[model samples]
Every structure is written in C-alpha cells, then in structure tokens.
Target: MGTPLLVAEDISISFGGIRALKGVDLTVEEGQIVCLAGENGCGKSTLVKIVSGVYTPSTGTISIGGDSFNALKPRQAIAEGVQVIYQDLSLFDHLSVAENIAINRLIHDGSVLSNRAEVQRIAAEQLERIGIDLDLDAPVSELSVANKQIVAICRALSMDARILFMDEPTTALTTNEVKRLLAIVLDLKKRGMAVVFISHKLDEVFEIADKITIFRDGSKVGDFTASELDEVSLSFHMTGREIVYNRYHRTRTEDQPLLEVRELSRADNYEDISFTVRPGDILGLTGLLGAGRTEIALSLFGLNRPDSGTILIDGKTAAITNPWDALDYGIALLPEDRKTQGLFGQQSVKTNITSTMLDRLLTPMRMISGRKEDALATELVHSMNVNNKDISVLVDNLSGGNQQKVVLGKWIGTEPRILILDSPTVGIDIGSKSEIYAKIHDLAADGIGIIFISDEPEEIVANCNRVLVMHEGSMITSLEEEDLRADGIKERLAEIISDPDSFAGTNSGARVQGEQA
Candidate 1:
C-alpha cells in the first residue's frame, strides 16, 4: 500500500453530555477505498464530519499528508484537498448542471460574473476527467438520481479533491445506478484518490471496499481488509452480536385473503395490477425502480386513489379515500422514504409513535390524554424494541434504524390488520434488518397480513412465502412456495427485466387475473 493520505488519531466528540464519538482512529492510504460500516448513530457520521472539518473534535488530531492539525476549518480542509459529498448531495436544484458543477470553483476563484459558457467549459472538463457524460445545460432538477450523483462527483473533482467521502451514496439509486456508482468509485481509486465510503449496504461495501472499519456505539470495533470479512462477520462487528435469520413460513388463520386488490390501475403509474394478501402472509413485491411498487402500496394505503380498481377488505368492497379511511379499515402503510413520508423528525418519539392513533387515546372529554398517550407510546416502543430509553427524545435524535422502528411503532400502534411496508429496511444496518425480519415474521404469525415491497431479491426470497414481480408498472409474474429460492427468483427477474418479450407467451403458471405485462 502507498503512504497514508489521511490519518485521524484519538478523535472524540460530545454533544450536550452525549458522547457521539470516542477515541476513534482511522487511516486511509492513497488509492484506498475504506468503507465505514456501522449502524446509524454509531459514530460513523461523527467521525467523518470531524475528519472533513464540519465538526471540530473535542479531542484528537487529524493528519493530512505530512501536516497535522488539532482542528481544521471547512475552508482549511478544502485547501488540503478534502471534499465530502453528503447524503443530500447539497446541490442547488434550480441551477443548470454546468452551474452546479462549476459554481464552487468560480466562487473560490472570486469570479463575480455569471458566465454560462465558462461554467459549461469547466463542467465538461471535469466530467471528461471522470469519463462521465452528462448534459451540461440540463437543469439539475431534471437529472436522474444517477446523473445527479455523477454531477456531484464531477463537482468534487472540480475542487481538486484528493480524498473524497461519500455518505450513503446509493440509498436513492436503482440497482444499475448503484453498479455504475461503484464502478466510478473504483475508477477514482485507480486514479489514486483516497475514498471513504459510508454505507449501510453490506453488499456494496463487500463489492468495492479495500478496507473495512466497523463502529459501534461511539467507538471503533475493529478495522480489517475486505478479504478478512464476510457479510455475517461484518454485521456482527457493527452490532456486537450474531444475527440469524430463518426463512418465512405461512401461518394464516383463514383461507380467504385479508386484503385483495382487483384490476388496480392509475394514470402514468401502474396498470392492471392485481394481488391478494392472506392473513399471516408476508407477500413480497419485487420490482425495479419506477415499476410502480411504491405506487401500488400508496394506492392500497389510500394516499393515491386508483382510477379503476376494487379494494376488498375481508371480502367486502372498501372505499379508502384517504389515510384516515385506510386506517379506519385497519390498513397501514410504512412508506419507503421514512425521513419525509413516515416520521415527523422534529417531533418527540412518543409523539411520532402516537400520531396515528390520537383518536383512540382521547379521554371522556374528547381531549388527548397525556397518560394514555405515554402508556401507548411506551408499550409500542418496548414491543418494537426501539433503542431509546427516553421516549421524549426527538425522533431526529435517533439513528436511522431507531427512527424506522419509531415509524413502525406508529403504524403498529394503530392496530392495522393489513400493513404495507414499502422498502421497510432500506438504508438501515444489517443487524436492524435482521431484527425487522424477525418482527415481520412475528407479525405474520399474529395473523396480520403484510405487503412487503423491496428491490432486493434476497430480502424477498428470505422473508416472503409468496413473491410478486412487477415490470413496467404491471404484475408480470408470481412465485410461491418451492419456486421462491434466491437463485430462481433472480434468474426469472433477470429474464423478465432483460427481455420482457420472451415471457409474453409463457405463463409460467403463476398468473393472476388482470395481470398485464
């Protein structure tokens, strides 16, 4: 390995009596791709922020090249060739791609004039440097998630970044987009740039990381080469425990389905989709991005009303015009994007957990009873294994996994008989995922049907008794029982996605009524 490009020693930081990080050390060599793996709130972000000069560590030192500093400002970090692409990307949505890429450099150079041509020229050169092609004149808002990420990388290159840090970079991308981003990271490493990749996806980390650093509860667990770790071992290190997952088995109380959708269709989103979720069944919905998986869940939860469809709850046609209507019918949706669609981040965990069931906690006077609210929140949090000891803590203060738990708690507290979980475990650590899988199985055992939507085939294969595959906003096929192995599902999904025409004639014996390709 080459000389260390960046070295951090004894890094520690505290916020209002909470030690967010403690005595963490990290070293990244030139051309190294070091992946920081940990559960949310485990000091990964804290250490990265300290290293990138967004936060000055209460104690410790950072060394870049041959120089060491007790603390560095953001500008000083930039001057030392450090750049961070945060999860949000931090790009101006209204600006053109060229402007977003070149605006930083123009400001750093103190160029006051708004020069569109100059911006395009600089943006093109940066894109060329990275060997990525993107339209310079396209508005940033119009770019795909993948292209926006490429633009972000080009923007970092424009600043002459020697070491780059990408935080959860692929959380919002499609499978192909993730592959492309990993290739770009590899290309960057080949070009001798030290990269710190922070992510919860163990598959991506195993694919690209040269070195892996594990963190748990504000401290380093250990650091090892990627060859030294597998997914289970890596998960153990992050969570300080072994997580064993068992395949799901159906345990329904009745022969009839708890919820059924017939000929569901919505303009520009989904078409001719039909499915059924029996009591105690964990129905997996697998699809690529924009396959209308989320849209279907939304319609089921009454967030989006289908133009032509019938929703049957307990074999009776139900009219679900809004979330309230859905809840009244004992249906709940844990949306894909928890940060926006699920949790009120600024509110307390108790508030978020009880937000969905305010009516049930009302007193004789019809006023919200604080005691009843606290009791319900505490019960749900305890039952859901939420990691917070203090229920009054703001939801924003919790880690991503805990925040997700709070969201689940909120829905489960509503006493929903049918739950629609859209990417329920997205962006959470592996340990948390195992816990969630266990909880889902437990929920199934209690006769609450679940519609589990995710892009990951492994999750579907492991957790669902039945799986539905969607393509081009339609249910193309379904797999059940013996047909739900990972390899088989992956092969079938690949065939359908790669050549939809090949399966147009072959039914595969898994067709449902109103299913369209």
Candidate 2:
C-alpha cells in the first residue's frame, strides 16, 4: 500500500548441503511494521540476517530506498543503515549506557582512543529523545531488563538505520514494557523508520504489525495485511496445516506426587511455595514477566539457592546445591534464557553436548577425553536428529531447530530423570517443535518427569498431562486432565491475583512485579 522501505526479491542462502533460504521474497514498507512468523528453522532468522547484513544471501537482490544493497560485510550493512537487535540483548553489562548506545558512532568515527564524554552526551540525548529516564553513567547490569532493552534500542538509533529488525523483541518484557516498546516503535514509524518485528507472541504480532509475512521451510508462503489475519488463521499458515489450539490437555494420575516441591523458598524470588509436577505431566506455569517462573527453574537447576525448601525428586528428599548436583539428582533444567544457560554459541557440538556431563565422563584429572565426548555428542546428535553438516560444527551455525536439538542433546546426554524445559520451543519452527514434541514424548515414555514452562497456554495444555498455574511468585493451582483449559486456568489465576484476601491461604512472601492488568 505504501512505498516499500526495504525489499528483498528471490533471496537464497545455503549452508553446506542445506538450503536455509530458498528464493524467499520479503519487504518492509516505510512507516510500517511487517512481522514474519513461522516455526524455528523456517528461514525467518535467515531472512532477517540477510536483511540486517549478518549474512549475505547466497543469491538475492535487495534495495533500500529503491537502491540496490548487499550486506556482504557487517560494516557495509551498518553503513547502509540496516540495524538488527537479536533475541539476546547485545548490551555489555560492564559498559555504561552511553558506551553501549554510542558504540557504533564512536567506533565509526575512528577515534584512536574512546570518546567517553561525547559518547555519554549522545547516549543521554538519545534516551532523552525517546523520553526514557535512564542515567547515562549507570552500568548496564544495574538497570532493569526493560531499561537495558531501551539501551539496546538507543544503540540501534546510533546506527541511523532506516530499517530495524527486532527478533522476539519482547520475549521477556513485561506487558507494560511491551507497551512502552510498541509505543517507541510507533514513534519511530511516525519518524519514517521501517520496523520488522519477529515474535512468537501472536497477540503482539496482531496488535503492532500492520502487515505480516509468513515463512515456511526456507521460503515465503505468503504475505497478508494485519487486518486480514487472525491468530488461528495465521497459526495455520505458520504451521502449514491445521492445528487445534487447545491449552488444556492435562491428564493427572490419582497417585502419589512424582515431584513434591515443599516450601520451595528461593530468597527474593519465590517463598514458601509448595507444588508437585506429577508423572506424565506438563506443569504449565503462566504469569506476566518477572513473575518468577524463570527464577523457579533456576533454583531447581541449582543455579540459585532457595533459602529453605524441600525438593522431593522422587518421594525422596534431595539436596541440590548446584547444577551438577541437580543433574546427579535426576533434575535437568533447560534454562529460560537460552543464551545464558542453554547454548555455547562458540563451542562445537561435541564440546557443548558433553559440557554438562564432563564430570561424569572425565577421569580424576578432570580432563574430558576426546573419544568419550565424541561418543556422547554423536549419540545425542543422532538421537535428537540434529540436522547439520557435521558434529564438529559450531552450534551457532545451525538452524534454530538444529541449535535447539543441540541444546536438547546436551541435556539428554546427561540423562537426568527430571527434565526441565524452559521455553524450549520458543522462536523455533513447527517441524522442529513437532520434533521436540516427539522428543518430549520419548522422554516421558522413558519415565522422565518433566516441568515445562511456557507463555503459550495452548502449548502447555496440548503437550503436558498436568498444568500448574502461577501468579506473582506462587503456584496458584494445578490443572488436572479435567481442568486443563486455558480459559479455566487463566480465570483461576486472575481471581487469585485479583482477590487479596484469597491469598490469605497462601503466605508467599516473594512478590511478582510488572504483571499486565
């Protein structure tokens, strides 16, 4: 409808034998939000990478402002004013806000020494212009997730990028932060910036996107106006088939609990919380951002300590003081933040696959033998169906699905009894999700108890046999086979959070901040 801001026609890219993107066509119009949606390994990231110049499409022609462009090199793409903010916030926590924001400009200016003062001024001005009240000199780690996110956006602005690609931009953002970010996006659009938002949250895609692009298996399926798409219809396109969007398929057994987390109190995260993840269970934990779903996983993984609590892994009390201990206790955590605790981007598949099991495989010298590591990695790669050229390839080079498979592989190699998948399917493709689902079934069939956490209520209902709903920092209620519906769970959680007196039954001291109304 409007003049295109950026366009790519017949884009193609290959990795070894795999055609990651095949003649895909996409565009972003000026002052518009066009979102691309699909399952992991569906070429969404590939397209974004090509547009942002992180990858040069093996073949394709691109134009920005109706002029030809190629992102053969990263600097070339940056100079061309195409910016990308990946799933991981690219801010350096040790750096000041100014340093992070003005990095591109300062480095581009070719200053022999860093221009700290000028960078600070420019960063502060950018924040001020965006109406965000952040201190320029503050260390990034000191800022909240929302503020740190703003800093990432400011850094993008410094590139003067006409088109910005945001991958899962609001994955961890609270509803309010999401609103603020959307407002900022709209403000940038009014100023004639083109934004390409990629996310799994369909509610967000429907709300902010003016146009939507659908990608399936390395090709663009079709494009549609936002008004022309709804969640069910769009899910069909993204998944390439009919998928019943049901969130309550829990089937709890009337037996003793498989896992009884009694008084699980992690200081400042959750307190005095008791819950059970039963066998053949998909314990659905839903809450707004910072509702402590992730913190709970971390404590279970032994990454963090609960001030006081009892974890009965299998009717037996267990002391899990660290990740190794958790693994030994048959508890494996697929961390919420994939980059932080999930993947080793720079490491080879072999290295990362056995990283979690080094203590188990290594001799007293603690050096993991290459043969043992290779054997474990090879087994996991095959078991998880990791599609890649070789086992030694860097995990980052693979598609999202394959990368996720590697993440799965790492955990499976450890072979814990309780497998904790925190948003394991986030930002991945349908086929990959199905594969992951099969893997989940396989793990369950093998009698591994699972605690699966996701924002998508539908995913929890369909894949899990039992759902546990959380609000603030407490597990409000558990959903059995009969009570696994999203609407039912949602209403229950809402009622619990809405009525303060109802919480008298629950004395959870840990608070959940920033939940959407």
Candidate 3:
C-alpha cells in the first residue's frame, strides 16, 4: 500500500453511560479502497463520524498526512482535505445541479454575490474530471436518485478532497447505477485519492473493496484483505454468528388458493400478472429496481389500484380500492421503506405496534382501552422478538432491526390472512435477518399466506417455497420446490437482470411451471 493518508488509532467514545465505540483503529492508504462493514448499531457510523470530524471521540488520535489532532471541527476537516457523503446525499432539492456542486466552494471562499455562469463552469469542470455528463441547469429535484448521488460526489470533489467516505451509497440505487458509482470510486482511487466505502451488502464489498474492516457491538472484530474472506465468513465477523440457510418447506393442505390474482394490469407498472399463494406458503417476488415488483405489491396492498384485474380471496372475488379496503379484506403490507412508509417514528412502540388494531382495542364507552392496548402490544412485541423491552419508548429510539420488528409487529397484530413483506430485511443485521426468516416461517406455519418481495437471490432461496421472477413489467418465470433449489437460480437471475432482451425469447409462456419433487 502507498503512504497512509488517514489513520485513526484506539478510538473510544461513550454517551450517557453507554459505550458507542470501543478502541477501534482504522487506516486508509493513498489510492486504496477500504470497506468498513458491520451490522446496524455496530459503531461503523460513529467511527467514520469521528474521522470525518462530526463526532469527537472520548479517547483517540486522528492523523492526516503525519499531522495529528485530538478532535476536528467541520471546517477543520474540510480544510484537511476530508469529505463525507452520507446516505441522504444532502443536496438542496430546490436548487440547480450547478449550484449544488459549486455551493461548497463558494461558501469556503466567502463569495459575496452569486454568479450563475461561474457556478455552471465549476460544475462542468468537476463533471468532466469525473467523466460524467449531466445538465447543469436542471433542478436537483427532477434528477433521478443516481444522478443526485453523482451531484453529491461532484460537490465533494469540488472542494479538493483527498479522502472521501461514502456511507451506504448503493442502498437506494439500481444495479446499473451501483456499477456506475463503483466505477467512479475506482477512478478516484487510481488518482491517488483514499476511499472508504461503508455498506451492508457483501457482494458489493467483495466487488469493489481492496481491504475490509469489520465491527461488532462497538468494537473492531478484525481486518482483512478482500481475498481473505467470503460472504459467510464476513457475516460471521459482523454479527458473531454463522448464518445458515435453512429453506422452508410447505405442506400443502388444500388445492384452493388463499389469494389469487388473474390478469392484473397496471398501465406502465405491470401487465398480465397472474399468481396464487396458498395458505402457509411464502411466495417470493424478485426483480430489478423498475421491474414492477413493488407496483404489484402496492396493488395487492391497495396503495395502487390496478387498471384491470380480478383479486380472489378464499375463492371469492374481492374489491380493494384503498388500504382500508385491503385491511377489511384480511390483507396487510409491510412496505419497503420502513422509516417513511411503515413506522410512526415519533410515536411510542406500543402505539406503533397497535396502530393497525386500534378498533379492537376500543372500550365500551367508545374510548380506547389503554390496558388492553398495552397487553396486546406487549404480546406482539414479544412474539416478534423486539429488542426493546419497554414498549413505551419512542420507535425512533430503537435500532434499525428493532424498528423493523416494530413494523412487523404492527402488521402482524392485524391478523391478516395475506401478508405482503416488501424487502423486509433490507437494512437489518445478520442475526436479526435469521430471526426474521424464522419468524416468517413460523407465520406461514400458522396458516398465514405471505407474499415476500426482495431483490436478493439468497434471501429468496433460503426462505421461499416458490419464486417469481419479473423483468420489464412482466412475470418472466416462476420456480417452485426443486426448481427453486437449483444452484443456477442466481445465474439465471443475473442473466434476466443484466440482459432482459436475451431472456424474453425463453418466456414462451407467461409463467413457467416448476416440477414438484
């Protein structure tokens, strides 16, 4: 490795008697990509914030180019050529792309008057340096998620940053967008800039990381080169447990489907979709970002009404015009974005958990029954294995895993016959993921028909008894039983995602039936 550009030694920090970080050491060399990986609440963010001058470690020393400091302020870190791009990207939605790129430089240089032409010129130069092209005059709000991320990167580079940290950059990006972002990161590395990538996705870590450091429960577990570890070992290091894939097998009780969708069509989102989920079966829907998987889920949950289709529940036609109708029809949905779509962040855990079942918790006087609500919330929280013991605490105070559990608890409390989980374990940790998978299996065994949607092949293979693959707003293929167990599922999925046109010829039938063993 070349000379070390950023070194953080023996970092320790605590808050309100709780240790957030403990004796963590991190180093980034010139022209190298280091990945910092850990489960949620594992101190990865704290350590990075310490290095980037957002947090002052209780005990540590950070050195940049042989210069040491006990702590740094925001301006000081920027002056030292350090930049951080958070998950939110932190761009002004109302401003133009050019203004967003050049605002940092203008603020740093104490510019008195705004110059539109100079801002566009600065943005053009930065974009040219990064080998990307975009309309500078376009408002940031109109840009896609991937383009917003690009603007964030250009904004950092405009400040002449030598060390860059990207936190969970690919969480919301499409497959192609992720690849483009990684290519840009590699180009920066080749230019002698140090890059620190923080993400929960192992495939990405292996693809772009030169070295990796793992954190667990506020301590550094170990560090290794990319070749030294695989996904399983890396998961173990992150969560201190082995993640075994135990596929759930369903025992068919009756031929009658619990929920059936026939000829479901939503203009640009999906077309000619048909599927059936039996009681105690976990049906997985997977596809690329814009493949209409989510739109189908939204239709099922009544968030998006289908243009033309028939939904049958218990062999009877159903009309679902809104979420309330869906709920009345014994259906529940756990959305993909928990923070925005699922939880009532400022409310108490008990309130969030019991939000869906408030009608049942009403008293004879028409007022809510507080005692009954508490008991029901308590039982659901325990059933879902929520980490927070006190149900009275606000949901926002919990970790990512617990917040997700709260969402599940809320929906499961509704006692729906059909439950649709959209990317349930997106930001959760390994241990929590295993727990959630087990919970899903248990739910199915209790005769709840589950519709599971995800983009990860391993998750589908592990927990689902049947799989449906979608591409370009249509169902490409369906795998069941042994077909789902085939080792080539990932390869097939890759082909479908990377080259949709090549797979279209094989889609002679709308849904290919899989053999049952």
Model 3 misplaced stretches (Cα beyond 4 Å): 505-517
1 or 3, which is superior by lDDT?
3
Per-residue lDDT of model 2, residues 279-340, tens digit only: 66666565555567888888888887888889886789988889878867878888775665
What would you estimate as the lDDT of candidate 2? Answer: 0.76
Instruction: List the candidate numbers ranked by TM-score, top first.
Output: 1, 3, 2
lDDT of 2 at 31: 87
Query: How high is the CA lDDT of each candidate model?
Result: 0.87, 0.76, 0.88
Q: Lowest summed lDDT over 10 consecutive residues: which window, candidate 1?
A: 508-517
Whole-model lDDT for model 1 versus the true structure? Answer: 0.87
Which candidate, 2 or 3, would have the higher lDDT against the true structure? Answer: 3
Please tell me which model should have the higher TM-score, number 1 or number 2: 1
**Residue-wise lDDT of candidate 1 within 339-361, one digit each (tens)?**
99898889999899999889989
Worst 10 residues of 3 by lDDT: 508-517
Pairs that collide in candidate 3 are: none
lDDT of 3 by residue, 1-517 (tens): 5899999999999988999999889999999999998888999988888887899999989999888999999898999999999988999999999999999999999998879888999999999999999999999999988999999999999999999999989877767788899999999999999999998788999999999999999999988999999988998899888987578989758658999999999999999898999999999988787889899999988889999989999989999889999998899999989999999899999999999998989998988999999999999989989987799999998888889999998998888999999999887777788888998899999889999998777787788988888887888777777776666765665555556665664552444332222
Candidate 1 lDDT score at position 135: 78
Model 2 TM: 0.81
